[model samples]
Target chain A: MTNQHQEPLSAMLDDELTNNELTQALDSIKDNQQSVQTFGRYALIGDVLRKEQELVSDDSFANSIQAAIADIELPMVDQLETENVASIAKHPKWYQRASQKVVQLSEHKLLKGSAQFAIAASVALVAVVGVSNMNPGQDKITSPVLNPVPLVQGLSPVSLSSDSFKEKPTANQVTQSRINALMADHNQQLRATDDKEELEKEDKKIEQ
Target chain B: MRILFLLITCFVYSTSAAATGTATATASTKVVAPESEQLQSKEQQVQSEPQPQSEAQPQQATTPNGEKINAAYWLKKLQEALTKSNFEAGIVTLKGEKTESYQWTHGFKVNDDGTEVEIERVSPLIGNGITAIRKNQTLSFFESNKEPYSISGVSIRNFIPAIFYKDFGDLVDSYQFVLVSKSQIAGRSAQLIRVESVTKEAYNFWVWIDVISGLPLRMAYIDEQGEVVEQVLMTHLSYLTEPNEEINKLFEIQLPQVANTAIAMNQQTNNWQLEYTPNGFELLKSDRHHVSINREVADYYLFSDGLVEYSVYVQRPIESFNSPLVLKDGGTSFVMVHADGFDVTVVGMLPTETAFKIAKSVKSK
Candidate 1:
């Protein structure tokens, strides 16, 4: 009922009380019915408080507070870097540092690209050899593998254009453009397939 | 080999979403209107029939013998029955992924302003007791969580009696009501009514009212596909003589010092029109809410006919937004759909199909 007993009682209810305080509160509750009822009320209040705190907090209390501060700090930091980068880019020296960072990020991708090319070349060599070894009746099986020759030929011209954009475009703008293009191309492919299926269905119905 | 690997990856990704209840396997199922020629013929037949008002009015308002019953006569009778009744019941609400169950007893008391304060003792299935005491212009939620939070400028006075009876006169401007059919609920005969939106943007609701007692037994919201999205039912009812003092005292108790901080930085606002709501559904009131931290402009729209009440929330967008689930229990499915910079979440005990339909119909302005 009083603040002295209630402080430890409330903390004990929240499981935040030190061992000594918890023992004292428990002893007090056992001795007096009023303290027992008060403790029950305190426990209920603590449970509700914990639930509400859980609802509002995105992560752990410490993590969420840190995250909120980081969020506030991040934009200011980015803005400072942008202004510095702009001024440095206008000068000849700082451009080198920026270019170096960009190169480091793309280094693994460049290595992966070369490895893919090597794999594709080996597959093509095997396909050509297999086609030569096959009997006359198996020509139909090799015909589909030969179709990728045209697609591989088409990639060279687009990669050349992409290389130019990669050199000059800002990272954010490049990312946004890439996302837009990928979404647009996917939508186009879906439309084409839908149209093809509709036409095929109509033709099948006509035959029936 | 690469194609096989890609196919396996795609299968895994698709199945994972289906397992979590986040994505539906049948989402891509196209709704094809059964050959437009048939629909056009049906439309012509519908247009040729007598006006809905002329056909529906006589059958609904009148008894089996066909005598006109004025709206005022039914409304008064409903008010009297609700005021006189002493009721205690257990209610449960399940909205996508959340369920809240509570037992409550309802009683009326006259305030200083002469308006009645319908006091409800809400003992939650989990956590402390909640006393919701509402009089004209004031709505207070006294929870064990903290100090009592009070909101003024209330339009609706009572939660139960207002929603129990169809008092549509106050809500005529906001909704259009149609008596759908007669159905049985909780072993009693009831009238089913459909409340649809007059405005294109609002959601619609269907409610079942007990015929003899004029009490609401069940309520459902219909989705765009004409499916019930969510439903809440009031099942067992009994009358209690002694007020549950333990529950009442829970409301009177003030919040402890440690829990003085805010649960949410700002009150969330829900803005949408309601179409085809029952006769009793009224826009009881509106209030401006201010918060200490992350303060933003917001409004709360409270609606009740005489019994059932729901709060419509509207607020400014929060960065890195997460949808709030008030409660989740049972097999009820709750869903939050985000599109065009607006997030609409539907929570109720309705079927998943119904919840999905309502979620899809919410269009961001």
Candidate 2:
């Protein structure tokens, strides 16, 4: 449900809310994600109205909030629908640019990490291996390179570390990736076979 | 009132390591006795031609004390004694610079109709190890964020000395076990057995078995460079032939409810026809699954010298790491290779050379 606090948020944004109502909204927003997001949106709305997105300078606060919400799943991007992405001619491309930027920024947390991107690129690797295997005389160097820029991958499950990732020697990287791929495959199969976790409940007959 | 917001990563179930608990046994470790035999006839037999089917399960060999026990009997007995004998051992696992200390206990009781199956527990004496309680077929893991659930298996956790679960005779295809040396381990009569690869060029393993109890006291995986890559050493040992009242009471226990889901059926494996596997090695399991991309299915094949198990993985094109890589961590080693768009890797408790050889042996057929 949409909050009825739009008026109160506007009042707070205008510095016109009563001390008591302002205190209540501030307190309530702390316990609710939607309310906090609403406050952020209200702040953004204030920025646009003041016609000073640069001067408002909520970037640091937004960054901290982004970090805090990094673990939470975000909404999907509807802006990248094929037609919109395919459009070569659209005047005042403000929406397209804004949506694309948002997608680039949030893809890490909202979608699976660069592993997802790697899968998309590696389909070409499949063709490369298949074609080369069939024809010994085929030019090995003719294989296409899908991902030239290696994406940053995190060690721990936090933010992708700021360090730039360099794709190692193609042979070595493929071999290591093969090891990881197989090990992960082994575990996934094992999990498929044995990984059901269920809660223990009372009043049910269970054999020892 | 002033507001104070505490931000915490509230994902309680992130770590899925089935609680690996370890405890140290109280028996003192003793000095190794002497070399019974090392580089020997076992390798010769592996290199020899046919007509050895009769001598395959040889049991004529005797220890210094005139006790008749060959590699097969000793290995089978070791597995049986571990599960049947009521005992506890303090274990220390070493891999490179890291060491983990833990204790493992096994016990059982007999009632009217059937014997109360062996009850076992492995707990780490230090650090946050998963504590596992095994009563009969149920293994329940108790650890943080891991909702207690039971799975039916001989071992819920991996650190059970590998030799305790395998048959050396079965390993005759990949490894040759010969009487190597006598080592006093855990203040007991310990016999060292050299398990060499049939290929002669791959990694070898040494096992120290308690002479009296017939239990494996220690296992060491030796690399081609003559360095100990990984090892599980028993520092203390104790065995109970007969159950006492206190032990019986302990056996009468309650365990977590087993999960209601269907047990994981074994997945199908790819029979990647590799030509050059060392003798004594057997195909343990095979499974095929997608790696990064579902369309690019990868083949995983497990090969075992009975005790030391390794997996050979093969997948093709679609961008993966390209160069040869070797990694050694804890008790496992990994070797990788990329060629002709096919990426292959071998991982197990073997030396880097052994894994490297295995990885290189993967032919497209």
Candidate 3:
């Protein structure tokens, strides 16, 4: 059904309406089912526009290819245009040559080539970084501290296990585990205490 | 004379109701004096009209007659602002040199049928850590590596302290609320209030509340020497007049089912007792369960003075570290002591000395 009050509904969603207009818009939208749906659609569109990053996944490589294709205006008579493009390829500038090449390549072939290049580049970069990280003479590097030190004083961070076990020669692994477990449980208990009380109140309400 | 007497009694009832701090009760009690049904209904409607107009309440009235507002009133206002205001804030938590940024959004909406809904979300600005989103009473935690789960709660216990969401009245016995001067925070004027421990058993909490919106602009934990141990600063805030588009979309999201299994079913009894808890500290809960991380069985007891809380664990003695090991992390102090046959550990946002004392007080009962 066509809604006569769609303008106010969208305006209310955009927060552009005055207080008096907002109340009037809300009052009208409440009675109309189509207007409510339109309001929801307007809100969803606004959210999509504002939080585009949050909604889209981290697939930038594919996005770049799609964006490149969008920038190239594909002709309606593609096969016929390709025949004409070959005949008119004389005296092309370097940039125009690159653009024409991109336009000539099919979309699938271009995507596959980009994907292969991205994978090979990432693999090469990983190899170089991994080799440097595995340097043999780096004696200063200890087993990367399994348990992150939660505390830091001024500049230096002192971990619970290392600081407390420095003087004692005994293996403090068990002690470290105990300390971590207790600390974790303490935080968990604090977080859950409020939930428990709320649950108990809900249970009481259900019982009553 | 009879009409005047009725008016006086009605005035007395209304004042007493206000003293009790219940607005609806005051409105209902005002109707008792009205003789005619029509007048009573109209009076009730007029009185209830102001209830929904909390936003229209003059901000200056918070500090009446140029007199400083009570700290508890500011805390109540903070709670109201956190729950009711439709705002998006960028908050950064500072602990030593480590800083973590978060995007916090809270919105309140009312449906056409008069049902109220609240949506609050906190997401880390950098990493894919836990993003907590609370829709009404169900709080859902979204993480990249784990399945999302939901729990029932009024607030998201993230960077903000849980005490801010709870009733400030519970802290009256333990904390001394002091109103400090106003300061500029995030370019907005803020009223500073300190919630200090009455018995010096916990770290003092200072909150700088935005004067206009009542939202917390900055909050810090100060030690005995008045050094800030850690702080959360609101970098910026956008207070919306109504629920924003993101908040409206959150209403449409179907949060995971409430994981009732997460709550401990039975309160397990422990064979240990703390002989020397702080003055206002009350036992919150005690249970015996395998520590989720290490799988070690330990008896645990939690104590809270409303503002801060501490957890005590009594586990079997282990011979790894020297006795009486203490560590301080930001505002949290961890104290562990190896007593005879058993070990006592106290973890909380209390001073190390207070935590040590509590850890030492754990005796077999």
Candidate of highest DockQ: 3
State the weakest 10-residue window (summed lDDT) of model 1 chain B.
B22-31
Would candidate 2 be rated incorrect, acceptable, medium or high by CAPRI criteria? incorrect
In candidate 3, what are the lDDT values of residues B1-365, reduced to their tens digit? 33332221112122211121223233333332233433443454356434433431343454564423467667777787776667788999986556889999887666688887888899999999888999888889999979998887888877778778777777878887888876666555577998888877788899998755677989999988999988999988876545567788887788999986755544566588688998788888888878889988888888888777898888888888788888767777888899879998899988888999999988898
* Candidate 3 displacement at residue A165 in angstroms: 8.7
CAPRI docking class of candidate 3: acceptable
All models, DockQ values?
A: 0.01, 0.09, 0.28
> In order, how many clashes per candidate?
43, 45, 0
Error of 2 at B22 (Å): 33
Per-residue error (Å), model 1, residue B102: 2.0
Off by over 4 Å in 2: A1-208, B1-77, B112-114, B155-157, B161-163, B241-250, B256-272, B290-297, B316-320, B363-365
Q: Which residue pairs come into collision in candidate 3?
A: none
- Tens-digit lDDT string for candidate 3 (A1-208): 5555688756655556666776566567555545544554454455457652123333552344233333333342232233222222221342243334334332212222322322322222222222222334543344332112423557532354344445444436787777777887887777778677756766887999
Against the true structure, what is each candidate's TM-score?
Answer: 0.35, 0.52, 0.60
User: Which has the better lDDT: candidate 2, or candidate 3?
Assistant: 3
Error of 2 at B63 (Å): 6.1
Give the lowest summed-lDDT range of ten residues in model 1 chain A.
A121-130
